[model samples]
Target: MASDRGHGITHCDDPRAAQLSGLLTRRRQTLGLTVEQAARATGLAEHRYTALERGAGHGIDLGGLKRVAGGLGLTGQPRETFLLLAADPDVTPYDLVERRRPSIEELAHIDLMEPNPALITDHAWNVLAANASVARLFGDPGRAADGDRNLVLWLLTDGAGRRFADVDEVRADAVARVRAALAQIPADATLQALAGRIAADPLGAGLWRSRSPRLPAEASARRLRHPLYGEASVLVTTSRLPGGLQLIVHHAAHLIQSPAPR
Candidate 1:
């Protein structure tokens, strides 16, 4: 029995190492290649190839490894594993979001809102992105102040108040809308930045000072001067998007009934 047991049986040392080594062995076995045949094809001796199959060989040439992989019908497997393993083990699926942020920003221009003035706002109601009509109607008026856009401030402050038919009602509703929007935002950095900008406005200051966000049961109507439609009253509706992006869509109200000419 002692004479029959020639050299010691080679076994992989580490469990993870053994698992990966077993995987390689399986790959080689699946290709119907004997150990000697695999070694000869990759220019390695049978003993060295056996050590590799046992997951004990180091200093194996990468090019030769590729050849051995090819001989073992692991051409795609090595490439796929290289790709999968080349990534940092600490790298998580969440890191993919960071890499894909620009794509999401690009998608913001995908024209989600219709032609009637749609804008993409982050939390706190400060417009981060806007469409052409949005830029034309609201943008031309120089809505940005100190790099901040508080819609409530626009309705309550300076010459901007004249833009709305009844600034008081509009300001109150806008403030309420901001509060509603704020409630939906998490403590995200983007949201906090917008909130900080908005809070810099005088009306926002007052709203913050009150520390009370009231939602009136009755929705109010407000009029705005559209670049094309002179004056229009739109019943503003607020909605939350999948990623907490704020979408403001303005629908032209029904034209008031007119008396027939005598």
Candidate 2:
């Protein structure tokens, strides 16, 4: 009789295993490829490919993963995400955020951004830090209630709708980002709770279920409404920091577009 591990494929119970399996299955289906075709494309035996899709295969190293990624036609960020998921299943972006902090020097650099609205957020979209401009523009995350400090939560449930002209577009983008992050860290309780809360809203629930593409890091221009400054078109850019933190900056296209409040 086979051992329990061999018979039951205990590893398949792991969260990462399930994540990989789902990703592979979704990609294959999206490409309209049958299992045999995908197996042939990956240069793997049909049985081996099936086992991989079931999250039961073992001993697939880096080269094999590369072959799989290439066969699936995953390029750019998608390919990189695939490789990282396969190679470091246990790595959690939140852990990186928890273990590191911005140096005073880094904070100084952020301060140099000055009038531009800039803030740092962790994988779960928790606002870790923000400059004065960000505080002035978006309402200081530091002063928000615990639940509202999460950008996604704020966008979906709190007052973000009042701050952006294209609130629907912004909400959709936030949902997509959260979906991608949840796939990478399925075991995170905080993320799971966040997803539940987002799904509680009718519009958010629809967005969560819809298949929307993840927006690029540098988003197109969006109109921001400030109580004192009125409305201005802003371009948002995001840069990855050393420790799973993101530096998001909003550059106004034409600052002071509207007259000041009386």
Local accuracy of candidate 1 as per-residue lDDT tens digits, 49-94: 7766665545565455555655666644463452222233443322
Candidate 2 ranges with C-alpha deviation above 4 Å: 1-98, 213-216, 256-262
Worst 10 residues of 1 by lDDT: 93-102
| Index of the highest-TM-score prediction | 2
Q: 17, model 1: CA deviation in Å?
A: 32
Backbone clash pairs for candidate 1 read: none
Model 2 root mean square deviation, Cα atoms: 12.9
Model 1 CA lDDT for position 206:
71
Best by lDDT: 2
lDDT of each: 0.52, 0.73
State the displacement of the C-alpha of residue 67, model 1, in Å, after optimal TM-score superposition: 35
Per-model clash counts, in order, read: 0, 0
Tens digits of per-residue lDDT for model 2, 7-102: 212244487667666677778888888888899999998878777776654667766877888899987667665666666455443432333566
Model 2: pairs clashing at backbone N, Cα or C within 3 Å: none
TM-score of 2: 0.59
